[model samples]
Target: MSEQLPAPDPARFPALDADPSWVLSVPEGTLIARIFRAGGTHPVAWHEFRTFGPLDGRFDPHPLPVGEHEGAGVLYGVLERGRGGGVADGGALGGAFAAALLEVFQAQRMIRLRDGSPTLAAFEVTRPLRLLDLSDSDWIAVAGGNSAISSGDRERSRVWARAIAQRYPELDGVVSASSLVPDARVVALWAGAADALPRYPAALLPLGRDELIGVIDRIADRYGYLVL
Candidate 1:
């Protein structure tokens, strides 16, 4: 049987009332975007710090993505902006979603262990990853018929619309990212404008989209956060 993991300590993120349910080491290139894929909910295999991203040929005991490796616990931080009225759009779901949640965990000052290490020294997660059923439709809505557009099936977008409506009736008529994640208590923590939205010109952006040193200007104007 797999070992039962320990849980996070409350003192890490004071803003959080309880310790994180899962402590994860995030890979590089995870962006907090507004992904609205239509269809069935996506499943993410819980990650191990070592297996979180890629191997650095194992010679150095660290991974190739040395720069982006960071650690964090999960939380249901309130979704501030959904799809409109100047709020940041809902964050992307799936692997990106899980990584986005990690951003909040890394924000804490106490356990800043993401200093380019290949493997996390130790960690804990309260719940069984098997129990986690994460879905993009659960927290985000489509921005347009093309929100979930796919080249695979020309009618895939229509099918997804019907499915989304049938699966999540409440999200019907939701056309913007803001409208989708209303009152969404996402796995997140408090952050400055960096995590909020870009406020300056893209050319002036140093990292362009690194949540740690980046910002989204006037959240309402745009919401997609996926790097690619």
Candidate 2:
């Protein structure tokens, strides 16, 4: 395996020379789809920053001392526009299902139905969101980073997120291409924007349900993933 990139140094990294035009605006009422555990944190809750490592989320807040930095939260999701209940490309899965499936079970390549009872939830944002678009190469350059922000080492990406959060406090979060899904985009929202999440998800489906198993089976068949 290639050596991992070192984390970005706050003092030595290039300055964040950002532009207002680089911001991506998600209109109010845009539905965001997520695969989460129903028994874990609420679907709309911002996950508090707690750990720092390669396994930590790419855009989770830097875990500094409580007083050392602005306390932050993060929510990861994908847009709901094209996630209709249909499998395209004959047998290949597409849209949020494939994106979320590959992302969640990437390590094991096994879809475990009972573990945490994984559920798919879709919710609408109450207000428009202004997000840093890291998917744009130009924006990455202006943000003092590169494509690593989307697909490189997560440890380094988290450091880059810290710098961006410090520089652009007004931003609700960011949008980046999914490392596992080439054609998919994923969103990471900061905790300060919790007001945007609706009280309840507009749609929810527990993967363990008997009815959903057929769909899951098809995904496994297409991708050669094992379902447990």
Candidate 3:
């Protein structure tokens, strides 16, 4: 039988309380937990520090069971920030977060496959200030749809949207980097600006129609605004 993990220490790793803040670290992993103002009946909100990688890889996705909760459909992403460009810094955190996200996806059974593979894309989270500042932002940017688009892939996008909708219900909408700059800007404006979108802009928007569609395909849960 698999060994049961050790029980967490309340003194060291306290149970999340109202507006609780704590740090957790495993050998190669670290988690920063913060409790935010509860959105619904639940007394607390949680944000974790983790990373993600492709499903073919060793890591398993985290568990996030879908429920009739208020914040069930919000999708989460990492926002990396730092002077160095190595995985050890913010990159590692992004991977860890992705891994956790996968677990949640698995728990919710939201995985969708197109060619016998998990329809998920891994991204490195970054930010203009500290990577930790991600929790404070109203929006996040999800990059790397260009490659998926070039290959005409939809598996990754479908699964991502389903998972996000299943998990964070509070998410208002999604903004794709692939949308025409002017068009995306208009949607952003309609949504009350970038902060109103679920994710923000960090990297250069992907070029070409295929790449743009690829980004949108991965995030199919949101309304698509056509530039033309």
Better lDDT candidate (1, 3): 3
Ranking by TM-score: 2, 3, 1
lDDT of 1 at 2: 25
lDDT, candidate 1, 162-198, per-residue tens: 3333333221121212113323323221111122222
Q: Per-candidate RMSD vs. true structure?
A: 20.6, 4.5, 17.6
User: Where's the lowest-lDDT run of ten residues in candidate 1?
Assistant: 117-126
Candidate closest to the true structure, highest TM-score = 2
Candidate 2 structure quality by residue, lDDT tens digits, 20-97: 557778899877767776564432222232232223677876555433344476768876545345333312123666
Scored by lDDT, the top model is 2
Q: What is the RMSD of candidate 1?
A: 20.6
Error of 2 at 223 (Å): 2.8
The better candidate by TM-score, 1 or 2, is 2
